[model samples]
Target: MAYQVTLQPSGHQFSVQPGQTVLEAALHAGYALPYGCRNGACGACKGKVLSGRVDYGATQEGALSAAEREQGYALFCSARPLTDLVLEVHEVTAVQEIPVKTLPCRVERLERLCHDVMGIWLKLPSSERLQFLPGQYIDFLLKDGRRRSLSLANAPEEDALLELHMRYVPGGFFSEHVFNVMKVKDILRIRGPLGSFYLRESDKPAVFVAGGTGFAPIKAILTHAFNQGLKRELVLYWGARAVRDLYMPQLPERWAREHANFRFVPVIQSPLPEESWSGRTGHVHEAVLADYSDLSGVQAYVCGAPAMVAAARRDFVARGLPADEFYSDSFEFQGGPGT
Candidate 1:
């Protein structure tokens, strides 16, 4: 039998299926309860059980002490509801509510997504969790006193391993290292949960335009939205130089197939004759303009090079999108060893 769990303060309620941990059920029910590690090892999911019995399945004493257990504390990641219960825990609602941290992470895995794009996964220390808002980015603190920033590609709900997509920049320091020398189990220092480009609370439909590897943060935002069961309509225009440049197009395609309110359109700027492609061809923003004659009712998020972002901002605003409804993150690759 499933047990109903109620959250204090917010008064939100969800069901905990048999054999499921509180954190797992809460996440499945679209609640963003704070958690790290998702195991008994980390106390990030520790919270008070206001009024019920729970089977503290495998909770480590180091995470939840005997005294704390006597005080009604339990690690939701390992706790199973014994009956209907009430839980008191703060939900992550905004960027400011999250703490920025400098943590050491090991390169857990690496895969080349395409000719120029590489997928990197960083595993944080088992005792730590980097709680962050979707769409925020992190900076790599290099040994040479240089920093490289990359948008996180995974949603907060799936925090076991952080994901990043890096585009190889020729002769660039970080890009060269990643493409040529970086290896699994290599330790690196990073600081973040930085940036203000996260999705804002609103009733308006959202339109996203991504260029090249700018798809990284947008992927996080979209995954978070889908996991939260957001009902708002979402459309994405992912642009690339050629079909091959779209490293992870299959993901959005799958989302489009699974989500009723989601749509994806891939735009190829200039496909060579040998490419054999039949789809929207041109700049990404132009595709949006052609489809939606009036953008006054929707929110627009554009991420790409400075030139693309600027042009999209200028043209989108002129087309009726409210100035405040438009958000963007513009980036450029440093010619010298930086990303």
Candidate 2:
């Protein structure tokens, strides 16, 4: 049996199958709902159940607290409606209606950006051109039926190649292979353009918040914005633990120098004595809030560790930024035997 789901405010309606989650049904019906880390790890999919009961699958306690559930909140990624339901969800507006594809790509080149970060370039099949928004990500199809996700580090252009920024995670399955056995010309299967974290075109000034390798998608979006001749003032706050973590430092510096409306601020959590670091210090998001006391008219695109994204969203919204204006993608590492 299929259950009917209605969205509040917009009044859009859709039908979901017995076993499908609300997000799956919404996506299948072309409803652009806000979401990230579809595995229920990020709270981006949380929405209020206006009128119907839902069975929330096993979700991390940290993702949704008891207080949130009591307030009628549920994670659309894992919630199965028991009957006709109405929900309060903010839909994403910049999502394009495009068919996703899974294809094979050849690793064209791999360059070490830092001691632990690698820049990987993948060439698509000549016959197929993968169309994806700058902030979207692709998942690697592993032999054991498992998947690993990585964000594209370059904007979509005429080129038939995709760039990815991968960080070496100690003991991570994919990272182990990438750092140890992966080679250029390797054939890998991937599916993508997934996630709704793309930049929304607006006249308001923009603030980009990035942490570690989370800067990958942000970089792509900035490049896309520049290529499209967007003139809105853009400030990028890139946070890292040390100087080495800002692997592609030169790229941002170059962008700031070349793009009249762009600015770059690199923040370091801890600077080594030999690093001679002299820049912004402390958490990246904190630096943003410190500079821009009021975010009422600004749009923020944040990507990074789950903790950083969560903190930025909470603080930014509390400080007057519209909730709808905050777009984010949290990179989660799959834990277990076969990551």
Candidate 3:
């Protein structure tokens, strides 16, 4: 049996089929809901059920605490509708209309940006170019049925070759294969561009915080903004462990030099003496907080480790950043229930 689900405020409705999660139904109906690690780990798709019943499927307890459940919040990615339901959740309209596709691509180049970060450029078929927002990601379909997710580092306007930045996790199978075995002309299948994190249309100034390889999507967003001739002020704070971790530092520096509306700040967490690093120190989000005492008038986009993303969201919203104005995608190595 299928049940109808209605979104509060917008009143957008879709049908949830038997065994299908609310998220699956929403996606099938072309309604974009905020989600990450669709596996119920990230808590990005949490929403309140205003009516009817749902089978709250498997979810990490930390992600959806019993207290949160008592408060009427459900993880849409893992919640299966038992009856007609009304839910309260913000919809992402930017990518709702964009078609997601599974396509074959060939590895065109692999440029190692640092000891642990590799820049992957995939060449798609000549007849088709992907249509995606700046901050969306693509999942590489692997032979063993395992999928590797990587954010598109290049903006949509620069779609000749899809760019991705991948961090080398020492014992990770796919990552190790990419660094050691993957080659030019290697054929790969990918489904993209997924995720709700993107550069939204806003008149407010933008603040971007990126940690480690999380700079990929932010780079795309900023580049697209510049290409579109946006006059809004944009400041990026990139956090890294050391100078070596600051891959492509010159690119953001160049951007700052060329664009009067853009500014780049590099924050090194643990700078080594021999690296000759001198910059803002500590967490990327904290750096932003230090600069802007009141973030009431800005749109903040952050991508990084789970801790950083969570801390930033909590602190930023607490410091006057409208809870709705903050956009984020927390990097989960083992992404949960990815769409």
Question: For this target, which candidate reaches the highest TM-score against the unseen true structure?
Answer: 2
> On a 0 to 100 scale, what is the lDDT of residue 297 in model 1?
97
TM-score of each: 0.72, 0.93, 0.92
Question: Which pairs of residues collide in model 2?
Answer: none
Candidate ranking (TM-score, best to worst) = 2, 3, 1
Span of ten consecutive residues with least summed lDDT in model 3 = 330-339
The regions of model 1 sitting more than 4 angstroms off are 1-93, 334-337
lDDT of 1 at 145: 92
Give the poorly placed runs of model 3, Cα more than 4 Å off: 55-67, 334-339
Instruction: Give lDDT tens digits, candidate 1, residues 192-295.
Output: 87655678888899999999988999999999999999999999999999988999889999999999999999999999778989999999999999999999
Predicted candidate 2 versus true structure: per-residue lDDT over 228-324, tens digit per residue: 9999999999999999778989999999999999999999998877898878899999999899889999999999877778788888988999977
Scored against the true structure, residue 178 in model 1 reaches a CA lDDT of 97
Question: Higher-TM-score candidate among 2 and 3?
Answer: 2
- Write down the RMSD of all candidates, one decimal each: 16.2, 2.0, 2.3
